[model samples]
Structures are given as structure tokens and as C-alpha cells.
Target: MDRIVRGLALSTITSSVVMAGGYKIPEQSLNSMALSAAYVAHTSGADTAYFNPANMAFMHGGKRYVEGGITLAHLPSNEFQSLPAYSGESEVEDIPIPFLHYVSEAMGDFRWGVSLVVPGGLTKRWTTPVQKAIAEEFTLKVIELNPSISYKVSDHFSVGGGVRLIYSEGVVKSNSADAYNQQLALADIARDMEGDTFELGYNLALAYKPTSDINLAVTYRSNIDLDEEGTATLYGGGDQLYHDDASVSVPLPAALNLAVSKTWNDTFTLEFNYERTFWSAYKALDFEYTGTGIVLTPFDDPIAKDWKDTNTFRVGATIEMANKITAMMGFAIDETPVPEETIGFELPDSDAKVFSMGFRYQQSEDLSWGAAFLYDSKESRSIKGMGTFHEGGAFLTTVGVAYEY
Candidate 1:
């Protein structure tokens, strides 16, 4: 049944930001967040290292740039109500996410850079009766190290690519007392194992500038399969009834972003981005158990996901306000990959409209500090057979410093 899918799927929610759009977090940095991830074709600083490495070639007389920051994400509680039966509320805790980027000054025609970011993940918990039966808590944490290089083909064109090294870990848990039987009562989970793993992927990009005031770009990130292998234990009557080594694998999905940006009068800039996510790679969640043991309950079943690919539209505008402060705002229409049948307790995700605002204070030609904020407004959905998801969203705040030489 799809019951087990909720447990396995919830384990896929790696972090607060990854909770967006089926585990993908587009806002990895301050400027990227402030611009609603529309900074790809209009990179202004070191953040180009990840969003558009090719644009690093256009930093203009700058030798090197570095930016570091953290995002504080406050996740709202999720309210669930089903016809003729279940109802409850669950919320993931607030999370603090950190990231860093560095782009080298061009030496000849080549520029190199590196980025440390959280690409995707899952985190959710439930204490209510209905969902607690199979999805008490599911958690995942992931980190990625991306290093890249760009080649300036000419004054107007550039190309770049990078290798992705991703590290991840996940856990799943669910238990109920006196739910199915009159005697057995138990609840708890403990584990650490070979499931902590590292995976690899790649990305490519192209940037074109028809004029110094116009920038256009496209980038593609390949999919990475996070296969976790570890020990799993199931309890009954306050004791361990099943114990064994287990394994499960899920995809991080591929994504493509295309953007066009224009600077007007050298003071105002606007950019529009179209992004596509390949989420159909996940059809089901199956758990494998090995050695002298048995799989039971949530771990013994396969859950169907049948997720589909989705798309998003984003636009951002930046205005240089005064001597040093540049203000910006962004808007996006984000689509959800999860289908109606698969939506469950672990993640109450849905299509969303996002609004963001922030500003950057340029301390000097070589130093700057900035802050940004965003509100994700998830659209409510009424399911025919499933529960009613009282749709909600998250608020994220970010602050950081950058330097160039």
C-alpha cells in the first residue's frame, strides 16, 4: 500500500530548504535567494561559482571573489483532514543552513571556482494517531561539493561545466501502541550504518552576452542516486522483534534552468528564469533487507510514488538605490512533482507561489554585505480519496558577506 511510501518518502526530506519542490532547494545563497534564484544569467558576485560558472569570466577586472552565508528557515505546521476518518497537524522544526562559494580571478581565458551547498533533502515528523502509524518521523541530510571551471570563448560567449560530489544520510521510523492489536505496545527507533554514502554527478552551462547590458544563460544538473545502506530495527511490545541490515535508494532528480537578463540605464536590471525538474525517475520506494533477519511492517512493503516531471517560472528585478545599497525583489510560480495519490503525512508539499525581497550594501568596490527573505505560499489541495492538505509554506532569512580582489 501507499502507507509505507509515506515513511520512506518522509525520510527523503533532508532539510528545511529541501522541503521545497520535492527536495530541491534553488536558493543556495544570499543573492540567489534575494533574486528567487533568477541570478543565473545575471550573477553579480562569487555566487556565479554555482549558478553560472561561465559568467565568472565577466566579473570585469576582478581577480577573485568569495561569499559565505547561512539561511534560517522557519517551517509552518501542516494541517491534515480526511473525509470520514483522519485529521492531524505536523511541522518540521526550523533549520539553519550554511553555504560558501569562491571564484578565482581569470588567469588567461580560464576561471575556476568551488561551491559548498545543500542540494536537496527531507525532514518531517508526526505524533498524531492517523499518520503516526507509519510515519512518526523521517529525516535526511545531504551536502554537496561542486568544483568548476569556465572558458571564455570570446568577448561575448563563455562555457563551463562542473563535477558534483554529494554526501548523504537518511532514517525512517514509525510506531503505534494499541492501534491494531489489544496487547502489543511499542514505539522508538535507533540506527547508524553503511547507509551514510557519497555519490557523484555532473553539470554543464553556456552563457552569451549580445551586449554588455544583456546576459543569457542555460544550465543543466544531472541526477544523483542516493542509495543508503544501514541497519534497521523494528520493535514490538517494548522490545526488538526484528533486526537486520537494510537498504533503500532514491533519486535527487535532474534540473535545467534557462534565463535571460537585461540591465537598463546601468542602474536597473531584470531577469526571468524557466526551470524544469525531472522527478519521474522515482516510481516506487522499495526496501531491501539482508542477512539473518526479517523485514516487518513499514520496511516490508513497497510504496508507489509515480511522480512526474515539473516546471517553474521565476522573475527578479534589482535596483541600485543609493551610494552602495542595491535593492531587489523576486516572484516565482513553482510546480509540485508529487501526484495526488502519493501526497501523505511525511511531506505535505504542493504547487506554490513565492515572494521575496532583500538588499545588498556594497561596503566598497571589493566588499559587500547583504540580507534577503522569502515566503513560500503553498496552494491548498482537496483530494477526492486522500486527506485535505491545509496548504502552508515557509519563511527563510539569509545574511552574508562577500569580498572581491
Candidate 2:
């Protein structure tokens, strides 16, 4: 019956990369593609509301706009060599994200907005009988509620601030290995995670325009300590098959980004971005005990990633054509966050490069539509653990739409 506890556990396939690898940052890469030169230009969609809320202040005709949309991501699974004899078919089934935003214009030279989005999270399945021997599957979910305000000091200089409200939920499982470990049958593990929990956190950002044709933007997102509280359901006949209350705290790391946009002429524009993720903070996963003498302890070891700060570089360009049509293209390089020592069935990550393209069409003076495509090819990484070592790489494809009212 520990099926419920197994269901509650979360599984990570390759190392966790919020945007570069795992779940792509649901933001539109095309919005940045079209207006690389405009100080207040952005993709005009629900996603823009999450990336740069201040951009809303400059809405055309000093009017407010509301929009919503979703992004779908696919990553095929592969055989993995490591501890727990898990199957190689573990991969992301499908990732769907939806969001909404509200922007207010010219608040006395200041702009304000609010955004509700799913920034980063995942659900992975390890179907191999061997892999399931260690643990069957894992799931994680996150929701962010952000409110922001910004001020324009001049046409070239601007600043902004905001607060983030985040809710996170996680579930994990494996064979009973310790006195603290929760025992469960593979079938029962899947039902426990059917439950979820929530928590809160905060963050801030800044942007600057240095010249008439170039603009730079930077942002910082803070870490969150997500605690899960829920009941574990039992599937089979057993005295201690399920628990009424169980809890755990997962550490979500923080990050920083620096980006620039340049205009060469009325027809072409370019953009570049550098991002850093502070992953060292993710040292371990803590589980809470309900009984005194001792209940069950699973993975209570010191888990540390020789993880170094990761870096990401990107370059994008846009071409403007007749009758209000625009095209987009871009490329990027991303570093892996997992250290070989800490890499496991949860996340097998490596360095990678990305290629993307998109387009926009004007439907009328007040309406428009946009679409984009992105592909990521990663370098194969060799990992040694759990008595064996194997090498593999990952590929990701993302497509999304945008609407500006």
C-alpha cells in the first residue's frame, strides 16, 4: 500500500535546468526577436507579463492589455546507467504551462503590472523494471504570482522592483532501505503523489538603456524553501500501508540574468543574454518524522553536487518586412549544473547548444499574432555510479503563440 507514498515522491531524470534543459521558461523567445531596438518593445503576450512587467507601462495609446497562452515541450527518454538498475526510457511525457497578466500605463512616468505563471517544474517516469526497483517515478509542480512596479528616469534609463509568491509540491519513493524509509509496492507509489502543497518567496530586478539603439536588462530571482504536507494513501493490504500526515522541505535555488539588445537599422535587430544559476544551495532533501522513537528514513545521506555556477549565452536577430510582418532567428550555448559525483537517475545533464526561429503578423492596428520554434541538442555526458557508468544526450523542441491586444 506504500503505493501512496511512492506516488508522492518526485523523480528527476537529468539534472534540473529550469529553462536550458528541463522545463523551458514558458517565455516567448520571439518577442525579444522582433523589436531588439525598441527600449520598451517586448513579445506582447501572456509570457511578457512574467519576463518584464514594466514593458507593459508603454502600451500603445496609453492603454492596458490582457492575454493568456501555453507552451508545450517534449523530451524523449533514453537508457541510463547508474545505481538502482532503473530503465533507460525515463523522459518528460509532456509539459504544458498557462499564464495571465495585467499591465497599467504611465503611472506618472512609472509602470505597474501583475503576472501569474508557472516558471519552472517537471514530471518524469522511469518505466524500466530495474529502475523501478530503486524508485518508480517522481513529480514536481510550481506556481508563481508576481506583482511589479517600475519608473522611467529618462528615455534611456529605467528601473523596477517586484515580489514573488510561489507554491511548490513534490513526491518521491524507492525500496525500503532504512528504518526511516517508507516501504511501498511499485503499484501503490503512483497513487500517493496524487496530492500537493504550497509555500511563499520573494525577488527583484533592474533594466537600463545605455544608447538610442541599445538596451540592457538584468533580473534576480530568489530561492524558496518549499514544504509539502499531505496524506499518503494505501493500495494493498498492510497494517502500516499509508500515513495520515507526511511532510518534507525542498530547496529551490536562485538565479541572475544579464541581457542586451541592439538595432543595426530599421530592418534588422540583434540581442544577447548571459545567465547564471546559483545551484550550490540545493545541498539535500529533508523529510520530516511524525513519530518520536523513529518512523522511517530513506535517503538520509549528505547529498552534494560538485556543482559549479552555470553560464548561458545567447544571440538573436529579427528582420522586418513589408505590410507589418517580422521574422526571428537565434542561437545559444548553455552549461550543465550537475557535478559528476552528484549526477544520478534524478537528472543526467550536460552542456548544450540551441537554435530557434519564429514570426509575427499584424492583423489590425490593435491586434497581432506571433509563433516560434526552438531546438536544443546537448553534449553526451558519461556518468559513473551505482556500480555502472553510461553516456547519453538529450533533445528538446518547443512551440508557442503570442497575442497583443
Candidate 3:
């Protein structure tokens, strides 16, 4: 029971290679995806509400800004090669994510904005006998709503903060009724679990413009714990063994970002960003079960997760061309928090290089439309005694419309 529960808990929290360092999805808007999440300091649209609310204080007064978009994500299957019987490939996944943001007209020196976005999620399924025994199916979905306010302190400085309302749902399933388990003299063990939770946090931002051509910004998002409570059904020897209530807790680690941008001749802009993720908050996976006379073995002990913090660097270039067109390109280097000693099937993550490009066209005086594409290339990782994982990566395409009135 303990072993199955541990696998379920991990798969439910972190398993998708399409996400960022952990299970976080950082590209929630057209500009964000086009710039590999490097649009923090030089935001020019309603998305400022989500990336850096402080920028709203500096926006053009007497106008309302609105932006909405959707992203299509395609994740390729991960190939594991080693011993023939131990080798398998994870199933391919395709997902659609949507985002919306709005900024209100200024009221004196104050401004307000709101955003609806998907912050993090995951989905992984393995059908091979060996892999299925650990993670047959694991899925997680998350959503967030943020409302923020900003104050213009001076000509060059502004401050803002927001409340984070989050909701999440998860499903986990595993089975071990196979010839390999029979060879090991083990019983036909299996488990099914479902859970959901709602949590709260906060975010803060600061923006400064010392000169007309330069911009600087900083942002922070607080951590929130997801306490998932649900029911679990266990099986042994193809027979129902136990049915009981279960619960587990995991952290949606905090993050901090520092960004700077410089514009040349008011036609070209370049931006650089640094991001820090505090994944160290996740130390262990402990599941509690409530059932009388239920033997707790292997499943009762807490599993160690000793994950470390990670850093990401990004750079972007934007060119304002003639004919009401804007072109953007970006690159990024991302590091994984999962250490080799603790890496497993649930989350086999690695360092990656990201590339992105996009263009926006101004169709009318008050309407604009754009499209963006991003590619995440992951490096192959080798485990000491297990196997090597290769050919893992993700592709994303985003389309959006913006209106100002």
C-alpha cells in the first residue's frame, strides 16, 4: 500500500515533460510564449496584469486594455532504452490551454487589473507491463485567478500586489498483475485514487524606468500547499483488499524574477530575464490513511524527495517593422530541480534549451492579432543502474487578439 501510494502521490504532482522546471507552465500569453517568458520588464499589453502588475500604472491613461489567447501543446513520447524487458515509451499527449487578462482605466495615480490563467498541470500514461506497474495513468489540472492593484509612487517607480486563487484536481492509477510480478513471488497489487483541492497565495511586483529607453522590473509569487483529500481502493491477488480515505500534501513552490529591457531608436528592443524557482520546499511525500485493522507496510513510510532550487536565463529581441507589423524572437536555458539520485519514472526531467518566434499585426486602430511558436528541446539523461531516456521534447503554438478602448 505504501509503495503504491508513493508512486501515486509523485505522479499526481510532477510528471509532464511539457512544463517548466517542475510542473509549472510559465508561458501563459502570446507575448510571453513568443519571448520564452522574457516579456516581464517591457510589457506593452493587458498581460501586464499577470506578469508585472506594476506596469499597469505606467500604461496610457483613459483607455481599457484587454487580451485573450489560447495555446496548443504537443508533447512527444519519451523513449527509455536499456534492458529489453525494462525498456518502454510513454504515451504522447496533446493539451489546450487558455488565458485572459484585462487592465482598467486609470483612477488618478492608481490602476487595477485581473487575469485568468492555467499555472501548472501534468499528464503521463504508460501501458507497458514494467512501466504500468508504477504509473499506468496520472493526470493533474490546475487553474488560477489573480486580481491586482498598482500605485504610481513617482515618475520612474511603481509598486503592485495581487491575490492568487488556485484550484486543482488529480487522478492516479497503477497495477502490477503481470508475469514479471508473478516471477518475483509478489501478489497482484493495484490501487486507484482521485483527489482535488483549492488553495490561496499572493504575488508582488515592482517596475522602474530610469530613462526613456530603459526598463527594469522584479516580481515574486508566494508558495501554496495543495492538500489533496480523497478515497483509495487497494487490491491484492485480483481481490479487493482495502477501501479507505487518504490524504497527501505537496507544495507549489515559490518563484522570483528579475528583468531588464532596453530600446534603441524606439524601433528595436532587447530584454533579458532571470528566474529562480524554490523547489527545495518539496522535501518528502507522506500519505495518511484512515482504516481500522489495515496493515501498513512499505506504504506507511515517508518517501524522500530532496529536490533542489533551479535557475533559468532568457533573452528576447523585438523589432517594430513598417506596415504595422512587429516581429519577436527569443532563446532560453532552463535547469531541472530533480537530482539524479532521486529521479524516477514519475518525473524524468532534464536541462533544456528553448527557442521561440512570433509576429503581431495591427489590423485596425483599436484591434490587434498575433501568433507565436515555441520549441523546448530536452537533453538525454542516464540513470546509474536503470536506463537512458531520450527523444523527449514539446512544441507549442499560440494565437491571440488584443483590443483597446
* CA RMSD of all predictions: 3.8, 6.2, 3.3
Candidate 1 vs candidate 2: the lDDT winner is 1
Error of 2 at 79 (Å): 2.0
For candidate 1, lDDT tens digit of each residue in 1-405?
Answer: 233323333332211112234546789999888988888899978889899989888776457889999998877778887632356678667878899999987888999999999876667777765555555677778899999999999999999999999989876766554233322223332222235678999989999999989999999999888787787675544576567777777888889999999999989999999999988887777777775654445444567777888999999999997678999999999998888877666667888888999999999878999999998898887766555788557888999999988
Worst 10 residues of 3 by lDDT: 11-20
Per-prediction tally of clashes? 9, 32, 1
Candidate 2 vs. true structure, TM-score: 0.78
**Candidate 1 ranges with C-alpha deviation above 4 Å:** 1-20, 83-85, 181-194, 236-239
For model 3, what is the C-alpha lDDT against the true structure?
A: 0.82
* Rank ordering of all candidates by lDDT, starting from the highest: 3, 1, 2
TM-score of candidate 1 against the unseen true structure:
0.91
- The Cα local distance difference test for each model comes to 0.77, 0.53, 0.82
| Backbone clashes counted, model 1 | 9
